[model samples]
Target: MASYASKQLLSIAIIFFCALGHLTSAQIVTLEVKEGNSTCIKAELVARFSVAYNTTNGTRTVTFPFPGNATVGNRSSCGGTELPPLLAASFGDGHALILRFSINGSQYRVESLALEYNLNDSSIFPNSSSPSLVTVKTDSAGILAQINTTYRCESSWPVSLGGGSGNASGNASVTFSNMRLQAYMLGSDLSRNETVCTADQSVTTVAPKTSPVTPAPVPTVPGNPERGNYNVTNNNGTICLMAYMGLQLNLTYPSSVQNKTVQEVVNLQPNQTKSSGSCEVSNATLQLRDDRTNLTFSFTLNTTSNKYHLSGISITATWPDMKEPFSASNGSLDYLRGTLGRSYLCSAEQTLVVDQTFAINTFHLQVQPFGVNGGQFEAAEECQLDEDNMLIPIIVGAALAGLVLIVLIAYLIGRKRSHAGYQTI
Candidate 1:
């Protein structure tokens, strides 16, 4: 029948759009910034949100992402030609993510972020009558800090931001995941998409860069750090942490209740992931999940200094034959230390033992406080192991060159002595 054929077509359409990833979700909600008569920027943001709320027993967390075709209301505000433009993606009940822009002469940047959530919304937060509007602001984390550049990332990892130090009463934590962005432009149209990010890599930093002329290129870090950008801001909008790096987790557990131990490798990347994290001053936490395994990384600042280091790790995983979940955790650790404002980079693989059954590792990794020039990683620090590896070749070449010079000098001296002995002959 004709009715049956129409139903089949509808089902096919749903599957196809879902396959396109977050891009399809944002396609229905478009935000644009304009200047005078020309459209300056076009953006489609597919963001995932996780909010922790108070429950009678304890704190419970809920994660929700805007679905495809969920843009039914005035979800976007993009028609403006003011000196500093504004764009917003609103999800009803006063929940929204708002971006404020600032322009100077020929350049523009994302000046601030304002995120709002409703504590009274029964659907978002169950059995709560806290009737107060909530708004969190990030004062000046310049997201698109470039001159006429485009920012695009469709990888599954999505940039992770927020976490740590939440209000004591209202919510224990809040986090945002840019599940994926498709061909988003900032300040201008896409001129070959200047900035791109994937699960294994990113062009990161949350600070804005300003210049009268063209801005310089944001530094590039290569060699498999698997770096992804992250930002954390307090209620005042001051950036507390900025980080980028690749993360890999190693889990050792019994394949079954009585079987021998087996190891599983999980890569923390955006292209294949469902991840969450929060950046805060003095402490940072990152979580990355791939396949059936999930990892939580806890980093802390040393009491003597602001150097951040990995302090703990926890993992949860599922196996094919197991009826119950498997988990492992360790809280006391000191690894991957670095200064607060700068980055730590190393090309050689390094591992940290969390316990007898679990470990964490990374190679070519870089991380820093995400609030610097254009939110880019600041001057970097090299790990000792990687530095040692680099030193080997240089030391060998220098030693060889020194021996050759020594031999040549001795030969010349001997010839001179022989000439002296012969005198006028």
Candidate 2:
């Protein structure tokens, strides 16, 4: 009977330990940010103090909150309570990913993950298995830099079917009406060369047993005059991609010009046009991908007047992303130097809210960049500054001036007629 009791006690103790062990083996998810190229970034998530193969779906569901107080925006797949779809997909991958995160409010589709784990854990038990930690790292610096330095222009490209994947090309002329146009042309060069060729004996009527006849050298096509690539610099540090409303992308190229020249010419333009020549691109979108942000933009560009208007730009990025959209305006004016400056006037702070149907996590961003340059009114093009409210002040000023002029004219005419009547009487 005593022996039976001892066995029962031992079994209960074993069960208790098993339950305790499971609880103690739970893993914690943590993340780190690493830097990368301007276009993309690397984000790292580390599952710490974990037992092998013990960290799965349930364990991962724990929210690893990021400290960046980004404006939590839209993520279409699930409700705002759950992980955004793109972040979920990127994180759901077997390995840790250096994926797009969010900045302020933006979203992206997560793609690949590279994960690592340590394999040494024996402190808890005398004969226990070794434990490892899973770490993920990505580039936040790269993302911020990309946002700061990058350029954006949207155009519809004409699509062609002759190529395997099909080809698309278009050129929408972008006129920098108010913007300064500075150009430099490189001189074209030409050279001559001589070569010899041997004729086939079968084709030539060779004297019986004579050597093969030498053929005239073929002429080489001369290299066409090519333009050098231009470099655009913001002399005042205020010029930005979003400032111009009359901006259109030019992609068409003349057949005679070499492709190198074509690249050089457009490369020098104030805003780089994505594709080249007479072809115009419509229904185009802008995509900004990086470790901290994945931003997708959809907008329109007018064909005839070379005007660009942004419809909307949406983004899908990391979870816990947040922002309050705000608008501010500041301009520069140098009377002595005649240097025009710009200012920014943004709308009141508004949170970004995304519809939850696209099945992908996304964030959002919007800007016009008029304030970045000094004077919206004095910009080269009339519509370069597109503030609906700015027109009100101008209308009121015109009305007030007209009213003053009418009152003065009535006074002057009444006085003149009275003086004339008195003289006549």
Candidate 3:
């Protein structure tokens, strides 16, 4: 009878250990639903349920159906309570689940189970490569209170959420519904934990316009005319004249007469013949003309003191059409006395005249020939001469003429008287 009692106690202990293992074992609950092609949603719950029995009573079996269209698989064990098979389901929005269980002749019921799901993955998260978190919450009567979770993979695996506009190559979405999850009672509520995964995508491109540039205007400048005049005296006393327009100049001998020197002291009758060397030319004039400009000069000869043998020449010029001032300069004077050619000489003393003329719009002188010395000449309206010293030669000539006339009359009267005294012998 003692061996029989020992065997009964050992069998009871074995049954209690089996029931404890069933209550402590874990089960998996999966849910899958769809929203559209652009999003993906999934959820899972790992849970264990337990039932308590009175110590005096023997073991009891409890069977329950999972809520909604959930199905069961993969049974497990726990401590002092038995865990039912795993439950899972899939449906559209707004689905419900109810869990019913009978433990030790007492019934426990949880009703009106609904899941509130949210996916926060959009174009707002620009730099995030990972999918957004999925949140699932149950009403007060459900076994799981709330779950913030993620899934391993999503249909829209890689997505670019950025600022621009273009179409995505492939678009897909995921969802979750009617997932039966089990949990133990803590105070007055039942709860489970889970994670769901999702993703987002976008593309954008743009083309910009360009602008044109404008060019700056070119500037205009007025042209300047070339102008200058020069005079040269050779060894034979002939004068050379040169005048310029633009870069061109007419180089010619204006005077071919050799200059004569005046004697320092001379007494002669009014009509007396004097050698050319004893008299010099004076009161000379030069006139130069062109279509746009005119130049004139009056000169005198001084054989004794003038180095150029010509002096007292004053220059004047006028430009009828030009509003600007005309300028000229005598740039050089080279006296090549012994090197002069024969054509530069003159045969006799005579008056020098020059009437060089042209017609042109622009004139500028670049070079002046050598063998002459003078000041620069500029275009002007009038030039005055010193005529006060010109009367000395005139007065001297009158006095000499009067003296010769008186002498001639006295000689004639004396000759007549002498003849009368001879009495026609």
Candidate 4:
């Protein structure tokens, strides 16, 4: 009888040990971050975590938060669940959780696989201000075409379900990758939490449409011809294209895409150099023309010292139809036309650092080869100096002569009337 009783007690002890081992191992848990949405440039982060139980009695309290100092809440459907008056977070709350997490070395690393991210927090989260998106394409091998950073209007925090251990000896761990971030508006009524759970369900779609770029229109006068292809080059290997008339255009290197070229007919705006701002083309000057006569043309070039230099060049040619006033019309205006060539010559007097920038000092460039169309000349004939220019001086001389004749006629008439009266007496 004693031996039989001892066997029964030993059997019971072995069962108890097995049950304890199963209980300790049964509460395995894992957490995952499901990305939330938001719109603010610097956004708060919200994530969802799921806790699963391998055994029954799987109840556990969860304290999840949006990554930043954000408030937390639950969906309307989850009424009376863990999120009414959700967690109010402060910057330094000892228990306040933040979004930045890492998972290389922590206690419970092995049991993290059974858990997943919960999808319930969509209602509270705001859209992402800058959401990262990935695009994959297939070539010979699968390739990633592009990765875009997008902005979303809303996002939420992660929800954790089914796992935790109150014992300090038990381990807890997580891995943060293939992850996303979202934000939520803090502080909503507690009643809404329960309603949010069952309210609605739909597949989340990427946001559609972006603001389109509109190029400003430039009004043009019908009859007046204007200059096009305006360009400027400084010695610093930089060439800026000047917006002609009331327009602004952007300059860029060859290797860019999208808004790479900003050509708009915007109202002319002045970029005045400030006293403290470093100057580029110190004495920048401009020449204007209406692309017609290449001979005697109007040109203005100014230097950094506020001094102006000008030249009016022309070449003359004789045509069969030329006679009197018509002959002078054949004279062509001489002007400089080649690109300022992406080269700038600094003022010989000053020293410049290798890559440092300085202002434009001198602007006047002389048009060499002054005479006939021999080298840079557009016409073959000698510059007509006399005939076509005669009209202005001749007109002035004729006016003066006519004025003298009028005065003399009046004096003679007076004298003749006086002599006639005397002779009659």
Per-residue lDDT of model 4, residues 1-425, tens digit only? 33444454456556655654543221211122222442211222233222211212422223232233333322111112342211222222222222221112210011112221222222221231211211111111000000121122121111111122222111111212122221222222111111010001011332222213212111221221222333344355333323122222111111123333221111112232111111133223333222221112223333322211112322232222223111112111112221122111111111100000000111111221111122232222211112113434665576557545554655565566556666644
- List the global CA lDDT of all models: 0.52, 0.24, 0.25, 0.23
- Candidate 3 contains a number of clashing pairs equal to 37
Find the candidate with the highest TM-score and give its number: 1
Worst 10 residues of 3 by lDDT: 195-204
Residues 177-248 of candidate 3: C-alpha lDDT, one tens digit per residue: 223332322222222222111110001121111111101111121233223333433446555332232212
Per-candidate RMSD, Å: 29.0, 34.1, 64.8, 43.0
lDDT by residue (tens digit), candidate 2, 1-425: 33444455456556655655543332323222211211122222222211112232311111121222221122212212343222221232122222333323211222222222232323321232323434432121111111111111111111001101101111111111111100010111111111111111112333212112212111221222122221111435432323221111112112232312120001112233221111124333334344433444343444542333333434443322123221111111000001122222222111111221111111111232222234222333211113222444665576557556655665565566556656744
lDDT for 138 in candidate 2 is 18
The lDDT of model 1 is 0.52
Model 1 reaches what TM-score against the true structure?
0.43
Name the TM-score of candidate 2. Answer: 0.21
- Greater TM-score among 1 and 3 belongs to 1
TM-score of each: 0.43, 0.21, 0.16, 0.15
Q: Looking at candidate 4, what is the lDDT of residue 36?
A: 40
**Residue ranges of candidate 2 with Cα displaced over 4 Å:** 1-292, 298-314, 321-387
Best lDDT goes to which candidate? 1
Name the lDDT value of residue 280 in candidate 3.
22
